[model samples]
Target: MFWFLLIGLVSGWLAGMISRGGGFGLWGDLATGVVGSFIGAYVFNLIGLSAYGTIGSIISSTVGALILLWVIRMFNVAPAAAKKK
Candidate 1:
């Protein structure tokens, strides 16, 4: 539980930095990062990769955060496009 919160906070901070002001508040970011961690793990598992309990896990979580940001951006842009049309 503590690990999840810490990981989530760190990952969320990184994700927010990478996204260039695209993320929400602390709680929101934390939630995103935590969920991203799971997503990353699932992805790694699906592709026959191992997400162990170390730095590799952090990397995997960050990768997942990147993917999550990409997804958020995609949906975020949709409304703009629709409004323009």
Candidate 2:
């Protein structure tokens, strides 16, 4: 549990930095990272890839975080575009 939280925090923080400027916040980042880890594993598995260990978890989380951010951005843009039309 401790390792999981630590990994989530680190991965989330890293992902935030890579994707945007910074994280949503400590708790938000942790949540995002944890969720992203699962997402990443699922996504990688779909492509027949698997990640292992701490480093692999971070990588997977980052990838998943990027996807999550992208989806959020898409939704954000859609509403604006809809309002314009």
Candidate 3:
């Protein structure tokens, strides 16, 4: 439980740095990390891949967070028509 939280924080920070330029603050990053953990596990299962140990978990979570950020950006982005207005 405790380890998961720590790993989530690290992975979230890393993902935020990679996807954007900085983190989304502590609580935001924590939320992203926790949600991304579930996403990562789901994705890995679908691909028949498994993450092992702490390092793998971090990597997986980071990847998931990146994906999550991308997805959020996609939907939240204004349409070209709206942008021009």
Best candidate according to TM-score: 3
TM-score of 1: 0.76
Candidate 2 C-alpha lDDT tens digits along 6-50: 888888888898887788799989988898888888899999988
lDDT of each: 0.79, 0.85, 0.88
Model 1 misplaced regions, further than 4 Å: 21-24, 78-85
Candidate 2 local Cα displacement, residue 12, angstroms: 0.9
Q: Against the hidden reference, what TM-scores do the models get?
A: 0.76, 0.84, 0.87
lDDT for each residue of candidate 3 in 1-85, tens digit (9 for 90 to 100): 9889888888889989998789989988887887888899899989999999999999889888888888998888687798667
Best by lDDT: 3
Model 1: pairs clashing at backbone N, Cα or C within 3 Å: none
Q: After superposition, how far is residue 80 of candidate 2 from its true place, in Å?
A: 7.8
Model 2's C-alpha root-mean-square deviation from the true structure amounts to 3.8
Question: Which is the winner by TM-score between candidate 1 and candidate 2?
Answer: 2
TM-score ranking, best first: 3, 2, 1
